[model samples]
Target: MADIKVIIPAYNEVDSIAHVVNELPKSVSEVIVVNNNSSDNTVKNAETAGATVITELRKGYGYACLKGLEYIASKSKQPDIIVFIDGDYSDYPEELDNVVAPILEDDIDFVVGARRKNLREEGSMTPQQVFGNWLATFLMRLFFGAKFTDLGPFRAIKYDKLKELNMEDKTYGWTVEMQLKILKKKMTYTEVPVRYKRRIGISKVSGTVKGSIFAGIKILGWIFKYSIK
Candidate 1:
């Protein structure tokens, strides 16, 4: 079994997927890219980069992630750790080591790569993104008593424990769902600061006003839904 397997969920990210895949640490045994019905050449690019590609006809982030998990579960030798990263190249691929190191050392079951706001490129995030992150994280801390900053896509978690969470968010709530489930399970979790940069393409969420509002509602709703349970 591989020590670590990185899974990237991509939708129309042909421009950035190859770079993200190629830059990953060689220590990572395999790179899996979930092509979420992208119209572009995302799969071809990922394949060209020597990444294992899986096509998920679904059009949502959660769907892509679920498909990736299913692929991993069917592997002959399951990886000890699974890392989730965005295919847009917004996150620093080099920092993947930091996210998985804690798990390999048995320090935590989940590790979130929190983007250092000051280090992120200017305009890389919209106002709604900034406020949504702050508000949602604050609510989680107040209600669920979990500490987290930006719920960016870059994260790592143990494979077995992740399955126990039974994640089911189908949209932008994916990140919050994972975090809330881990907290509810009382699993060890930690956050490490990571660098963020501008993505090659525009974001699907937080790029427009309507998308941000909907995302915020879904995230907050999930937090409260899981907390009251």
Candidate 2:
């Protein structure tokens, strides 16, 4: 069986973290939850749910993910696939098998869990978030001839291929950065439609004006920078 590992970057996701940890498919060998300076019981809850939790004081989605990668690196046996999913229960964790299917069964280097509009719960995504996803994807198609529909956080990539990308984004640009790099490198990738719903708690990004603005800026900045490159 191919070994698979999952990385979840959490902030104050106390209510949702345990559900995300416990709902993962059994195919996953380990679930690494990186607590991104959560002030809640995220760590305790994750531990109680039988997850390997770690602390990443640096407060960024990329920082928490990188911390999880560092932990996996220290392990004697590395996973064949690395899955990245939000700590929020908005994403259906049981579909992790679907997310990694392309890589495992088709030899694709990466797989994105695309949240199609029809599959998403109404009000699950903010108006700005929907517009942002549309604009970003439109730009990607214009500049890179990419076919990505959504920059969904639930995605999977091969371990070796992931290392080759040398991802360095430290904030909201993480998802777009990965897609851009995949395009730049001409890597084999695909998207699998996945169901989505409102999270257990308010989103730290889309729920706040400042968070949404910064995230939009970061995402656009990366796209423009890569387009010029």
Candidate 3:
């Protein structure tokens, strides 16, 4: 069996961090939670749940993710695969196996868990999220010739290939950055249908009208930025 490590980037997620950590599968060899300047007990709660907690004082999703990657790289024996899951508990931890199964068994490099829209609870996603997904996917297909649905957070990838992607988006652009980079690299990737639900706290991006506009601009800008380069 390939060694698996789960990386969760958390920020002020005290309410859901512990539950998310506890629900992860035992098949995972290690869980690394990067506390991104959280003002709550997120770090303590995650540590209590058996995760190896790391501190990323810099406040950004990319900062936390890069910190986790650094931690994984420092391991004497690096993990064969690394799974990125949100610490917000909006995603189902039980479905992790399905997300990584393709990569593990078939030599696939990446797997994205596409949330089924119908399965999502009411108010779990705002109207802007639905439209944004449509617009972004459409733009990616039109510009980059890449097809995708639901840029959901629950995803898995081979460790070496992730390093090759050289991800560096600092804020809301992180998810789209990964997608665009993987496309540009021509890596093998697939999407699996996964369940979604409302999160314990409000979303930082799509929860507010202003956040939604900024995120939309960033996502579209990245797609076009890479397309023109």
Candidate-wise lDDT, in order: 0.90, 0.94, 0.89
Write the residue-wise lDDT of candidate 2 on 1-229 in tens digits: 9999999999998999999999999999999999999999999999999999999998999999899999999999989999999988999999999898888789999999999999999999999999999999999999999999999999999999999999999999999999999999999999999999999898888999999999999999999999998
Best by TM-score: 2
How many pairs of residues collide in model 2? 0
TM-scores of all models?
Answer: 0.96, 0.99, 0.96
Tell me the tens digit of each residue's lDDT in model 3 across 112-183.
Answer: 899877868887778999898888888888987876887888999999999999988877888889999999
Clashes of each: 0, 0, 0
**Which TM-score value belongs to model 1?**
0.96
Candidate 3's TM-score reads 0.96
- Candidate 2 segments exceeding 4 Å error: none
